[model samples]
Target: MPTLKLAIADDHELFRKGFISMLSNVPDFEFVLEAANGQELLDKMPGHQPDIVLMDLQMPVMDGMQATEVLFEQYPTIKVIVVSMYDEDRFIIHMLEKGVHGYLLKDTTPDEVEKAIRRVADEGFYYSDFVSRVMHRKMVNRLPANKHPFFPNATNVGLSNREQEVLQLLCDGLSTSEISDKLFISSRTVEGHRLRILEKTGTKNTAAAVAYAYKNHLI
Candidate 1:
């Protein structure tokens, strides 16, 4: 069987050690590297490109968010699974926007952590039951006519279904190629949808277009 190479970035030494110890017992996983913070992760990345990264959200010398941005910019194929203590919707949305493949709360059991690694390594998404519920609630509350606090807008220049699908994936931080693969569309078709989305939403770039979609409940 092929081993899945993994790295971890966290500030707490004990937690990092504990995580490595737990992962060491997993048969299919290989803990290849560890870092204390995002900057260290970046500094060490060129030498070892892991298949999966377990990252803590709050760290010094560049937080997980910053690290995610850099990682996506440089190594788009590396899947990052956030293993943080935060469960807030805002934090989850932000991480999703920054392109994290999975979100597992820090208090999750070792078995669950192992499962998440396997799941994300194979499928590119891992959400515990609680996390899945939270995501569902957020999505339900954000429906255009819901009139909830999280709802962005009710009636706007609504994007087409395909456009909305692309926009949601984009907001979730999937790249053009990834989106194309997920939707089983051509890259050129995905690019065309993105351009039309920007034009319809009056946004300048992918980021702006995503912001507009979220702000307008188009996604």
Candidate 2:
């Protein structure tokens, strides 16, 4: 059982200290760094090499969203888990799209915090039941058929109905496994659909595929 190095970035000193205090009692958790804002976290991250970061979305300098993006761009292997007071679906969806490993509300229990960290570290993502339901609903409520006019060549790209479902889920920021569960398909099958969707849409990655879907009203 190797210790997991942890970093926390939050503007509130009291909340940050509370997390540190809680982590201090856990045998397998190591508190490596704390920063008041995103820029400071980025600045301190290079040499510390934490395994996971507990990020706050609202901070004085740069904020968590920008920091998460920059951190992953620079160090893609680092796992980021957002811990904030916000439980809004939109915010959760946005963080998911930006490739965060997990989302936790500030009021989350200590046990949940531990679970979220371990799950994200081991399984790649940790979305609570609420977050999962929101994601599922977002995908289910998409327009029945393509309603908006698409790009000149995009409509001709011809994505199938199943592939369109996968694309909408991707746009909603569901992980491959989450999408699989939602659609009652295997993750591999979901991935295959994703690849085909990209190919048919002539896009490169999930983000691009999502953009193409929105622009073409394929969702």
Candidate 3:
């Protein structure tokens, strides 16, 4: 497998160093650079183009939110995974709106951190359980009166009930294995459903499919 280059941007020197040390042990990850703040990360970006960035939300200069915006705006191919201590819905939703590939807590385990990096690199998103729950709750709470949260455009689009169930779980940020477990189906079946949903919605990926559903007010 190809190694993924990584960058870390946090204001805390000790935390940064410890993260770097932990990541260095992961076989598939290559630590390319480190930054004390968002501006520093940006300044180093031109010189070292990492495939993924582990960003901290709060910093002295530029901050993670601004840095994430600028990074994606300037280099759309690079992926960003926001690793912060904040678990508030606003922070999670704000980063999601900014198009981050993943959201992780600061207290995340080394295994989950590695998993998040690999998942985001491969699957285009890695929403921890907390992040997914928060997003689902917010979206459900914001639904208009007398409209089904899972099928806003059910009549307009001929999505089957099973597909809607799959899509809703996807929007909740459940991985394929998790979805399969929850639905009592095989992972391959879940993947087939995912592909069909993408095809039906004319989307290129899971993220785009979810975006289409939300854009058309499906979920």
Candidate 4:
């Protein structure tokens, strides 16, 4: 298998070294570059062009949010996973809005980190169990009436209840395969539901559909 190229950006030297060491044993991950801060990350990224970036939220010369915005603007294909000490809802929401593929706490184990990287690289979103729970609860509490819970302006015109459930699972960041396993259905069935959901909502992608749902208080 081809290795996944990764770049790590953090202000602290010790933590950067520790992270590099921890990832050294993961077979498919290759550390392609390291940066002391977000500015350095931005400066080095054009040349290195790693597939994934492990970013710290707080760093000198430029913070992770700024760097992430810049990176996404310039390199939309590169995936970013924020590994930070902060777990505030504001920070989480902000990073998500800024297009971070994953948000992880700093205390995550090395194995968890490896898993998260792999998941985000494959599925486009990665959340720990705790983060998942938090997001779910938040979604439940914020669910809006008169809108399909997964699509705000979506009329729910021709969708069945099962399709709505699948959309919710998608908005909750479950991959189609995961949704199939969770619902005890086939992956192809889940994929069909996804296509229908996209059509009904008039959204091109999952992220935009989710954002529309959230913005209009649909979920």
For TM-score, candidate 2 versus 3, the one ahead is 3
Most TM-score-accurate candidate? 4
lDDT of 4 by residue, 76-159 (tens): 889899999998876776676666778889899888998888887776668677666655555666646555454434344555
Most accurate candidate by lDDT: 3
Clashing pairs in 2: none
Tell me the tens digit of each residue's lDDT in model 3 across 77-112: 889989999988888776776668888999999999
Off by over 4 Å in 4: 140-163, 171-173, 181-219
TM-score of each: 0.69, 0.70, 0.77, 0.80
- For model 1, the stretches where C-alpha displacement exceeds 4 angstroms are 143-219
Cα lDDT for residue 77, candidate 1: 83
Candidate achieving higher TM-score, 3 or 4: 4
For each candidate, the alpha-carbon lDDT, in order, equals: 0.78, 0.79, 0.82, 0.78
Number of clashes found in candidate 1: 0
User: For residues 130-183, could you state the per-residue lDDT of candidate 2 as single tens digits?
Assistant: 666666565556554444233433346777778878877776667788888999
Q: What is residue 95's positional error in candidate 3, in angstroms?
A: 0.9
Please give the lDDT score for candidate 3. 0.82
